[model samples]
Target chain A: MPLYLIGLGLTPDSISLKAINIIKNCSKVFLDAYTSILVSYEEMTKLMTEVLNRNDLIQADRTLVERDAGQILNPAKDSDVAFLVVGDALCATTHSDLYLRAVQEGIQVKVLHNASIINAVAGTGLEIYKFGRTISVPFFEEKWKPVSFITKTIENFQMGMHSLLLMDIKTKELDWKLYMRGIERYQNPRYMSCAVCCQQFVDVLNTDNDADLSVETKQDFEEIRIHAAKAGFSVDSKCVACMRVGTDDQKFIYCSIGEMAKLTEHMGAPLHSLVVLGNIVSDMEQEMLNLWKL
Target chain B: MPLYLIGLGLTPDSISLKAINIIKNCSKVFLDAYTSILVSYEEMTKLMTEVLNRNDLIQADRTLVERDAGQILNPAKDSDVAFLVVGDALCATTHSDLYLRAVQEGIQVKVLHNASIINAVAGTGLEIYKFGRTISVPFFEEKWKPVSFITKTIENFQMGMHSLLLMDIKTKELDWKLYMRGIERYQNPRYMSCAVCCQQFVDVLNTDNDADLSVETKQDFEEIRIHAAKAGFSVDSKCVACMRVGTDDQKFIYCSIGEMAKLTEHMGAPLHSLVVLGNIVSDMEQEMLNLWKL
Candidate 1:
């Protein structure tokens, strides 16, 4: 009995024939639900169950994944177990830990790779090789405000490479408790939108720096262009929009960063990513960005 | 009529159900063959053709792709057309250009994402977010030796980010002609092996540098540890090996660069990638790499 770490890809149809074949053979199926949410979780689960003809699909939240991985591993020792993850299995560090844990426990492991947002961001017309280290923007708190992402973005800019900023998602139960007790009662899981992310970027640029900034660096921060996209399940539904930050016309309009921050129109659903462009390397990228120019 | 840029993931089974369904409906199908080669191209094409019940699948070499893309796009204007690519559809900049072309022509286009070597490299135990810009090591010739990859790898190391070095493949027909007339008759396709890449790196460090090198920088080039892997179609068949270059005992042995350059063992088939570790960010990565430690 081996443990299979399978990637569900981006959409219900994105699942590979091999992945479905493995799921149909597994005795226990568990879906990891904390790192990132699938575009349509219910629809994906329904499609999986229907295709596999198995109703024993279980959802493994952060608690079960981080603290009680043994619950999945113990069963894998005697039965074929499948742990399905959104995007690619190795996209999240936690899933890689699980793969290592299974190997350490002497339970054979297999990983089925699929599309992850890491590579899918190429859909934004940016060259994948031109991307630098990726950063995540966590929800800011009154006491804990991280500007490391800003520093990383500046480094990427200096290196002539784009920076990919992943928006925060509240999926862990413990984090929910922390939010519910302090703020309004826990509403549905919160996804950081492009509007909020834009606001956060502006706030960081305006408040975080204490050193003397060069005139060019100041202008870079003020007029930096951002490419924001809600890459939905498929290409047909994806939305890619770009805007510069400090200009006038602040609204839902795709104009400046100030404007995009105040936007109320929804890009789509959850899982939004922002790309702060560095030096536009190719003619095609420049041309593509021009289409979204305000 | 719409053009679909579909990805054939890592393995034959990595093809998605949606891709198969769409291929069944597509009136024309062309496979791009120059950028990267699939693990088992013949096996995959056979499986896809049989499953889709179609035999009109055309292999689009670099000439056809770069010079006669209209052969695919023109037909796409009047019928459903699919351009199948290895790895993720847009991972290669050329495919992205083709996509832009389709859009500019006002022909509807859809991209079906799949696993790319970019994401699949995560299986090497290096965190995806920590990887910096990717570099390619082309086969060196008398007049066209390129050592820019070495410079970029050093930059990534200084920035504390890992570097993914894509080994060059001679899939272009023009290059085949250039090599065939000069050297021995061109053999089947050549995939840069870890031994050859390690040797190439050593050669670059030894002869190609003119800048002043600090002791630490010199040591960095001398003792850089690289993770090499032949990621096969199945997880069980995948091989991940690590070695430190410049150390003694290099005969096809998983050791240091100085040793690896002279080795003769074949590290399996083509399409191999190398990862020069910058700074291991997590204990898990260290632990995982330990398994492959020489």
Candidate 2:
């Protein structure tokens, strides 16, 4: 008996035959429902049940996977179990933790890798080799606005390396207000758009407040802006906005960060990403960017 | 009719249902024979033909794909055609060029992405977000040794970012001896081993030869050595050697560069990669690396 950790890639039919076969033979199938979503649970359940000709797929939310992981690994002791994740099995740290847990328990662990946004970012025609650290931009709420990703983008640009910004996605989130009133309700899914992300970048760059700083010390806004200018990144810096990459209707928009912040009216869909260009864009890359210029 | 660019991932069964559906309806299917190899031509042909129940897969060598790409694009003008790549479709510049060509010729193009080494490196347990620019280690011939990858590795270390080294792979390579004698014969495939790559790193770092450099000015050996040392990368720097990733028999070995260089006797199969550890390995990353440490 083994625990199969399989990646479903990023599309409805991106599931591989190898993964499908493993799911078919597994005594239990658990889809990780918290980290990311490929499709609606109803749609995925319908597809899997139709293909495997079995209806045992379980939706494992954060509570089930994080708080009670025993439910996922316990069954594998006696029979094969499948833990399905969106994108590659090891992309998220949670899955890696689960893998370690399975290994610690002396259970056979098999990982089936698949496409993830980490690799799919190559579709932007920017050389994958030129990319530096990947950063994520979270949605800015009234009270909690963070700008660590902006700092990361500047650091990457200073090194003449491209920065890949993965926009935030909130799925099956708790309605805090309702929860506080002793009523439990889930909020609608929210995905950060490039427009909002760029606006945050501009706002953060213009601000003097250090309330969001998690580090021990903070610097003046003037010093930070000077460093950013030296790194060749400003609100006017060129960046690429990607929407639903790898799918049929996938779209890309190339413009300055400032222009993208103003183009909020055109921002569309979930699962968006942005790439802040570095100081060393080659001629070929520049030509490719021209194809998607706004 | 759209020209489908499908990624087969890194395994025989890694092909997705969406890619299969697209290939099944294509008037012609081409397996890119130059960039990389997933399995042998015989093995992949058997799998695709058996699964799709068709035998129209054309092996598109460099000559056909680079020189005569019109053949790949023209058919899509009238009917759907598929150009299959081993990893993700846009990971290589050649495929992106083909895509631009198709768009320029008014042919509709669709890209079906899949797992690539770029993302599969996540399996090593290093945070993908911490990776810097990717570098490649070329097979060092007696007269043509290059060390640019070493410079890139040191630069990545300077930024406290991990460096992903894609080992050199030679498939269907021209035998220069025969080609010079007016013969068109290709030598057997060659994949650079992590052991060889580590040894090259040591050799390049120890020597002061400027002959391998293509830069405008030559650098002194001592100057390069000092920079590398300051960047926290030496022959004894910690690194990870990955062999045949995304496969069932995939193996990882974490050790010093010098140690890996000496452990050449155990270097296994094709499709190898190396990751030079940076200065910023987190506690979790260190624990993960310990799992595979030698």
Question: Against the true structure, whose DockQ is highest?
Answer: 2
Q: What is residue A32's positional error in candidate 1, in angstroms?
A: 0.9
Q: List the residue pairs that clash in candidate 2.
A: none
- Per residue, candidate 2 scores C-alpha lDDT tens digits across A52-166 of 7777679999889878999999999999999888888877543667777877998888778888888887777898888988888888775565657877889888778888999
TM-score of chain B of each: 0.76, 0.90
Tell me the tens digit of each residue's lDDT in model 1 across A1-294: 899877777776788888888888888888877643563457666787677766677888878987899999999999889988878778765466787788899998777778887887776667889989988888866545565676676677667788877887774334556566675354567888777876766664453562445555545444432211111111111123322111111111223455556664745455567776664457777665554544
lDDT of 2 at B217: 28
Q: Which stretches of candidate 2 lie over 4 Å from their true place?
A: A141-144, A172-186, A206-220, B172-185, B206-220
Off by over 4 Å in 1: A39-41, A172-185, A207-259, B39-41, B142-144, B173-187, B206-263
Q: Report DockQ per prediction, comma-separated.
A: 0.38, 0.69
Whole-structure CA lDDT of model 2: 0.82
In order, what lDDT does every prediction score? Answer: 0.66, 0.82
Model 2 lDDT at residue A64? 90
